[model samples]
Target: MGERISNSRVVISGMGVVAPNGIGLSDFEKALRNGISGIEFIPRLAALNFGCQVGGIPPITQEHIDACFSPLQLRNFNSDGIIYGMIAAHEAWRNAGLEPEAESLDPDTGVIFGTGTSGIEKLNESIKLVDAQKVRRLGSNVVIQTMASGVSAFIAGHIAAGNQVSTNSSACTTGTEALLMGYRHIKAGYAKRMLVGATCEHGPYLWGGFDAMRVTNYRHNDKPEQASRPLSETAGGLVPGAGAGAFVLESLEAALERGAPIIAEVLGGQINSGGQRGGGTLTAPNPEAVKSCIKDSLVMSGIEGAQIDLINGHLTATVKDPDEVAAWAAALGRDKSNFPYLQATKSLVGHCLSGSGAVELVATTLQLQRGFVHPSINSEDLHPQIAKWVPREKIPQQAIDVQLDRAIKASFGFGDVNACVVLRRYNS
Candidate 1:
């Protein structure tokens, strides 16, 4: 069992994001504060057979399209994954200040990224072409392009990282799943460094599928930004958006030796599945599973709930999700008044699915770096029932006043795959 892989420290040395808020850490933060929703009005896709006129990453302009990727490169690749992975991974490597040609790191550096709803968009496009009698027009690259792991492979090539690379497709929990795997690799000494996170690209096919589930917002199509109201009374459902977030993980020792700027220490991460899989609604979460994961994660970190200063919740704009999660917190005997502060990043960036945890992870790191907490913009009135369980009124917006040092980010995937990660402020 390779010595059971025990007792090692992991740290988050760097991170990068490609959100609807656009690229660059500074610009992204501005959007977060100003509450600028990236969802826009696209005239072309608007006329398509769809129910909602909504927001999403706008169409790629010709100059940007041509400058970033070529027809040959994307010939067999999913355009959504290709665009997101390239931008996110590139920014992550640059942010780490790891010279592309650095010789200090080992060749065994690993990569494990989470991708939710991969290639569905491209698959839909190809199927449409077939229906239109454009048989010969179909490109030969369809098979490779639609592969879920295609983005991971493309990203590995860019870094010239000839090492172990893997991909996770665990719906919403995928990003945190990838990070957990990387943490294990470093702790087990299998790899000294790794790049992990998640990404998503919005497309008509994805939206249509969600619509079929009758879980998406149809009433607020005209007001795209208002479509997602996590803890609000009029909340209907999640407004699917697209973006990518990546993190560079390195052993604490390795990072200090290189003198790189460390963002936060990833103390421990744990995952748990719900009991009697079929008992819970396939698309929903379970309180037992949430409580189990939280308890187990704290045990792994060897910290009490009282030690954590913040709780970054997976508060997707839904009627039941917030209640389910708050119930779990209450079940653990966590006094709503004193346990930990709570904030939901989905309230800011919208839900990025695979990239949600990754983006929140970065957001938490920024909180630790700047000593400020981000508020769930526009959530003035939290649900009354949930307020009893979630003590904090709303995610704080002003500069952080307290000496907050540690936080937890929790994510729940579609199949009740609950993942919780703990982070500590870097004291250096």
Candidate 2:
């Protein structure tokens, strides 16, 4: 880690997001500012007799699909995660002023896009064909579509990435972990620029396991918009969602030389796990580990916890919301009276699972760039335990204007894994 201090500084040059609340950066920012809810009822889930019939699926139309994929490339393309990841990656590449159709491979640019369970829908289709003795009908695209690295592989080809192109999976921590991985790659001089993000597919096939675990909200089937209630007293289980968020990370020197639009500076980050010990389980995070991860992130960033203007927390509208708040407060050594402003993107977009961390990071970057804190909608009634650690004003219910200099984003996932990143508004 000490070597990173002397290496090149990493900064975000461009960003693209396909969140349930919004598709592109402009619409995402608008949706966040306006506190629009993207969770809605799905007829397919209802027809499937799912306990939770509503979800946060991005409203991707045929036009959106056509813009990113050619007719030939779209053949037998059933992986929603790959489509979302490619769309976001292409947008990020173009946003950074790079041509995706470049004939030559970019040795200096790579990809670290990730997904939790890629192409579950495609896998299901292939299974049915194989069971029915129609193996030949599975087609040549099945392997690419159903592979866990499909998202990264597709984007790497689209951009002609000749560097380290790979995918990582750590349950819900996948996105934030991918961002940190890219940051380290540039800091270590492994690549000059890297496209980093995560994507996840939605629908019963992928979400059924969570529903069976009884971790998904089943009470809000009638009122979809109010389903995800992070930090609220009436909060239920999480509402499953899917989407992708991507960013182009390059060295500060490279970005300046190329005249790229610097979105935010990646100060530093930390990734660790609780080892499922000391009260941590496969499904729950250890409080002490979460606090240590946050504290270490600030140390790596060379900033005190007091410098954090806001905390984009991984509050997934479950019993863990209060615990997460307590962890943040403890890590920063701040009380409710002086705690930094906290925002929960999941309140509006639900839990995007593997894609949640990256999508939330995009929202964090937009707030830092545009000077505002989007409201944590559906949290009008703060959780009692959380209210004891965070003041009501610290959790704004509506958008507020503020010149944010720095922010910290943290994601906690299953398997007791955690990832935290410190970001600053680009100064130069």
Model 1: residues >4 Å from true position, as ranges?
A: 1-6, 41-46, 58-78, 101-106, 128-140, 275-279, 391-394, 397-403
Weakest lDDT window of 10 consecutive positions for candidate 1: 58-67
Candidate lDDT scores, in order, read 0.72, 0.92
Best by lDDT: 2
User: CA shift at 310, candidate 2, in angstroms?
Assistant: 0.4
Candidate 2, superposed: residue stretches over 4 Å from native: 1-6
Per-model TM-score, in order, reads 0.89, 0.98
For candidate 1, give the lDDT.
Answer: 0.72
Tens-digit per-residue lDDT, 75-163, candidate 1: 55556755776677777877887744444534656788878756786787789999999978768877656777877876676665655
Could you tally the backbone clashes for each prediction?
A: 2, 0
Give the per-residue lDDT of model 2 (tens digit) for 1-428: 11222389999998999989899999999999999999999999999888888999998888878877789878998999999998889889999988886798778889999999888888999999999999999888899998899899989988999889999999999999999999999998888899999998898988989888998899999999999999999998999898999999999888998899998999998999999998899999988999999999999999998889999999999998999999999998888778999989998898999999999999999999999999998888899999998889988898999999999999999999999999999997
Q: For model 2, what is the error of residue 396's alpha carbon versus the real structure, in angstroms, after optimal superposition?
A: 1.0
Evaluate model 2: give its lDDT.
Answer: 0.92
